[model samples]
Target: MKSSIVLGLGFGDEGKGVVTDWLCRQAQRPLVVRFSGGHQAGHTVVDGAGRSHVFSNFGAGTLAGAATFWSSYCTFHPVGVANEHRALVDLGLAPVLYVAGLAAVTTPYDLLYNRVLEANQRHGSCGLGFGATVARHAGPHKLHVMDLFDDFVLEQKLGSVAAYYRQLGVSFAEEVLEQQLEDFYRAVDYCRTAIHCTCGRAHFKNAADHYDSLIFEGSQGLLLDQEFGYFPHVTRAHVSSRNALEMIREYGLPEPQVFYVTRAYQTRHGNGPLTLEHLAPQLHPTPYETNVHNPWQGEQRRSLLDLNQLRYALSADAQYAAGLARQLVVTCLDQLDGPWWVSDDDRRTTLDTVSELAHRLGGHWQNCYGNYGQAGNLVAG
Candidate 1:
């Protein structure tokens, strides 16, 4: 199978949306499988017709007419998926989104607990309950996507989860959770006809015989990985190629092509340790830009490209990336119009920054994409 796994090498925003859409189109509209992350993801995809969407709870390849399969490693938020579905239909697009039965479901209680806990702890949560949902799965009061289809099981799970939160001293307006529960059911009913519940990885991997390729589109970036990422600021998911590699091995699929994405410069949303945190890059604002300041993630900060951080991310992700054909996708090249060097303080160097970074990244990258598209055609590297 002509399969490829797309990963983000930075802290969240690395243009994975556009890359996934491009790959889907190139692969004749292959199924986009989300391996990790959850509703907190903001993958911005700008189509060929200039219509842009920041996809969450749906695969980034939705704009490219690819079905989205939320794998078991993902956290399914029915409300977010329903909201996204409504928005996409308004934009004249119909996205086929499915959730694995075993995938954890994030509920209103989880969101409230997450917000309250983060407010007290300030651990840099996305305020979307993704971390809380993942944490809750360790106990018996867990909820999954399949529970939504069963009223008895849904209520039982909801009651147990609420009790668990109360025991954890999570204080919130209880009526709000009821309202959100009502909304959640409405959203689930709204998406019932479209979103299928299946053994996602097995079904999709076996069905790969019909499609030309399978695109494992990951959410967030490796810098925010739960296990290997830096503490306190990391996301609550495996943001590396590990899950994709497991799926490949489980289903007997072909070797995966690793497409690691990063912006030309370093950017971090919320609080995180950045090496060159002070070196500001020229960021000409545009409508297509997705990252923004919100109460959840605070400010979307920018800085010069941190090659050291990039190297660390690559190294940390390498444990699961063995034997994967590595490629690179560099976005936000427009920010590099001015004189600024990533490797050093010498801004007088005539060497192009992209070329320098690529050379440092090594010559093994089979493909290198600059900005929204490939910088240039491959010339027998």
Candidate 2:
């Protein structure tokens, strides 16, 4: 009844994908479950087939014959899920993914509201209706996948949402509204027959009873946790092991080892804290691509720096860390170049060479391993 939950300790894109894929490969097969967030997540898993799949809706275990279950906390984009299914099928993999019938759907209105709100006012959002959708469902006007089964209820909810948006001076074209509703209904139909999920509790209980291990995968990173994160700028979801542990407890599964996935260098997609200017000269340069179009245009890549920020994040989520994590997994060690530094130095750092910048920062290094092909090697302390 061993159950493990792998999560990002920092902001989103903390290499949880590689960690999840590695665990799946090690198990050869396991029940993988996604507990939080929604289609806004970008999980990149490079499979044993050497084909990489970026998961937005589906879990990473799809390639390795792991059955995936999305809990009610997660929000779904039917089109995104469908596209992912097609991608998996094209790769000769079974897209046998299931979602809780109670999982909320991200509608076009949600996307529109997200774009409009975050356009000029920068909230460091992914512009994927992640926050908007979550906020909408947090109150009296909640709508879930099950609600789509009732036409009157669904229409009433949509009308309410539309009226609320109109008060905000955001109007949708009638045709657009009609088409979105149609698409929503179509997706509900497709999901009901193909990918709808039930027995969420039974699935976990069975996995705990029948399997050697159960791995819970979390999206986003801890720094973005709504409760513990930088206020107003954080993600709406709780990106910590706490949520994972809660899910395990709810399912009556045995507590297993928790692994916190992090990268050697700090990387952030949207606008946020980064000691970019100082470290930029030494690190290998890359372009930052925006996942969506908005006022937060242009991609900015920065070099990893020794910031107190990581320590602060760790402290904030200490409770979750103290309870779940047995070890920390640092990824992308090979990708990093030049000396890891506390302060940016022009002389010792080089773009292609890897070196230690300072001894003080070097102490921050911990026990972790790296993945390369079939073998995973320990980074010598």
For 286-341, candidate 1 gives per-residue lDDT tens digits of 66666778887788888777776778788888888866688887776665666545
Clashes of each: 0, 1
Sequence-dependent TM-score of model 1 = 0.93
lDDT minimum window of 10 residues, candidate 1: 372-381
Candidate 1: segments with Cα more than 4 A from true spot: 344-355, 372-381
CA displacement after TM-score superposition, residue 282 of candidate 1 (Å): 2.3
* lDDT of candidates 1 onward, in order: 0.80, 0.67
Lowest summed lDDT across 10 adjacent residues in model 2 is found at: 350-359
lDDT per residue as tens, model 2, 68-154: 888887888876676777788898887767677788778778877887777867778878787888988776556676666677887
